[model samples]
Target: MPYKRIKWLILWTPTVTIALWEYIRHTFLLPYLSMDLGNALAPVIVLTVTVTLVYKLFHLLEQTSDSLQRERLAKAAFVEREQLARELHDGISQSLFLLSVKLDKLEHTQDKESVQATAQQIRKTVKHVYDDVRQSIASLRSEPSMTEVQWMQSVEEMAVELRLGGLQVELDWRLTDSDLTSKEKIELLAIVREAMLNVQKHARAKRLIVNAFKAENISAGGFNCTIMDDGIGVDDPALEAKGRYGVRMMRDRANAMGWQFEVGRNDSKDNNQTVGTVVAVTKGG
Candidate 1:
């Protein structure tokens, strides 16, 4: 039986049954049965029915709760797997594409210096792919309860890596541990990392800045993270020719976390020249 129907039955059955029993005892059974005997049996009958109904109701509730819990776990696992697949497509796949392009160049080059350079580039691409795979594995093994300091260290490590590539990187982080929830922090970090990688791979800029702060006017949660680079602006033709999966993935991550994602050329103080590109992810306003 449906829980609601059983609950209603349990509530009304005892009262109605006792009322009818009393009516029959007084109106008809009084001739044969004593009032004391009828009254004495009424409590026992009510107790039996009440106990049975209570047990059934509790059992149904427990079963419902357990089913809901299992559904939640299954859904969470599916989402995690989907995210890992996307990361592989965006990170490792892109590196392999670069490696293939370098190999094509190596095949056509005749000069010894050019051939050596192309081979070096291929080696770097292969190393990058290896690192990406290792990072993905590490992420899967990482604890969910990552501290704010650890997150900051991760961002700093990314900046250091960019520096090794000869890009000047700056960090201006102002968020505290309480600024965002654990899931929010994770998604935001992913978006930032994607932006930085795009700059390192395609921006052709000398300097980059990563800024994170609270801005009530710009975000509902008063939180925002921006990646600004003095690279070829967003209007560059080469960017469009390259696939936009990285940008699309970053936008999807922000949207999934209920955040706002925007990418455009930075506003220049001097209107005569275009500046670098800027990518911002903000808590939805």
Candidate 2:
């Protein structure tokens, strides 16, 4: 029961009991010393007890409410910190990648030109940025994305929870033979992971189908992951927009990769109302 209801019981039970006792004593002990003293003393004692009991009950309720609120606030703070750390790792590290690429192009030349010397300076600067980004990433969050095997492992682990919950999920993936950087892997994993969570939550999905492929989109290349589920569809037009930081996090990861991010409903041939959400990451447009 809620604290308010408990308080109501506490207040009313005592008041009723005291009133019944006074009525009985007055009716039965009428001939005894029914003096001004008894009349004055009985009311004073009853009021004192009522005040004391009500105060204590209120104090208990106040303490419990404060403790629960403190716990909720602490949890919110922790989640906020984790989100900030993830953003710094995924966002700040991109500069290091660009710097490293430029430095590499400048490094390999038999020609002892000013460009070569400038390349050395650029290499040194890139190294500094790389070290800082790595340190911050270590302090933040990640899942390796460098190889196909690691990417698959990350996806499987992410879905292990659903398996534990007894949901039937089928995950299939295809990767480009080309290797990806660690930062790219994290971006891909975070984006895919967020989409998976949405499927588990709003979809009420008993069965899920995930297909990932690597392909070129125009001049840009990207990894595409399509998730289909036999679950209830959402009606909100702004579900993708006004929803919490989940969509924001997905978009942020996609932005860092210069990838196009698309997600929403599509056709279900079985008529069991299976809907799909596709997240295509292409070179940033």
Candidate 3:
């Protein structure tokens, strides 16, 4: 009987201690100790509590140290990103400008072979530089500023530029001019631009919607820009498709800007006439 009791006690050791400390603290340790023992034993109690708290304090300090390190690292990364953005915009981006100018001057040349060769080289170089800057810009995700009018001008200008490059372009806007932030405007424009490029390259849509505005529930304030085409729409988004690449890229760009990126075709319930890939972005109300 004694051996059995001892074995049970060993098994219940933790539980008994928990019951004493939690349920029977007054009878366990308080009544036997003097209330005025504080004067005599305050230091010991305080020291015991403080010693236990010291571990928490150390954990807090370690967390603070980690936060400081993270902030420093993030700052360094931002600085580097800015530096790279500026250099590419200033340096290689300028190279595109030069090439454009030289190509312009060569328009009067009569040598078919030379002209073709020169044009091919120009295309190759310009594409390489553009891809580089685009990669860099995509990486940095730099936010540039513009008023509503300026924003319109920038998008239209880019559309015209693309049109001149032999890609069809269209601009249709219903979102009124208001206090849209620089970041918001840029994000929306990026969606339009990516969608346009997708239409040109993947969808093989002859016609394009370069700048389109969409709204729901409220007008002007609560609005989104959309780009729709008559090209091939990806039937399944879960599977990788040509148009989906642009859709996914646009969605990601919008997400990074805290905006909702929406992709749909016009054949559904609300709008079935919508034939091709549609890129949409929502703005503030």
TM-scores, all models, native as reference: 0.54, 0.45, 0.57
Give the per-residue lDDT digits (tens) of candidate 3, residues 1-285: 243444454455445544444444356657676656534564554455445654455556566667778999999898776557454643374446546744774686688986886687678668767766775667555434464226676467556555644556767676555645566666676566556655655676656764545556644545667777777775655325653444565666677776666776655422344466676676544
Candidates 2 and 3: which is better by lDDT? 2
**Per-residue CA lDDT of candidate 2, range 158-257, in tens?**
4664564446778877764364566776667667766676676567778777777765654344556666777665543745556445666777777667
User: Residue 103 deviation, candidate 3, in Å?
Assistant: 11
What TM-score does structure 1 among the candidates reach?
0.54
- Candidate 1 at residue 137, lDDT? 82
Q: Could you tell me the lDDT of residue 190 within candidate 1?
A: 69
What's the C-alpha lDDT at position 208 in model 1?
85
For residue 112, give model 1's deviation from the true position in Å: 3.3
- The stretch of ten residues in a row with the least summed lDDT in candidate 3 is 1-10
Show model 1 residue runs off by greater than 4 Å.
Answer: 1-35, 47-63, 86-91, 97-114, 134-189, 196-224, 227-249, 255-259, 264-271, 275-278, 283-285
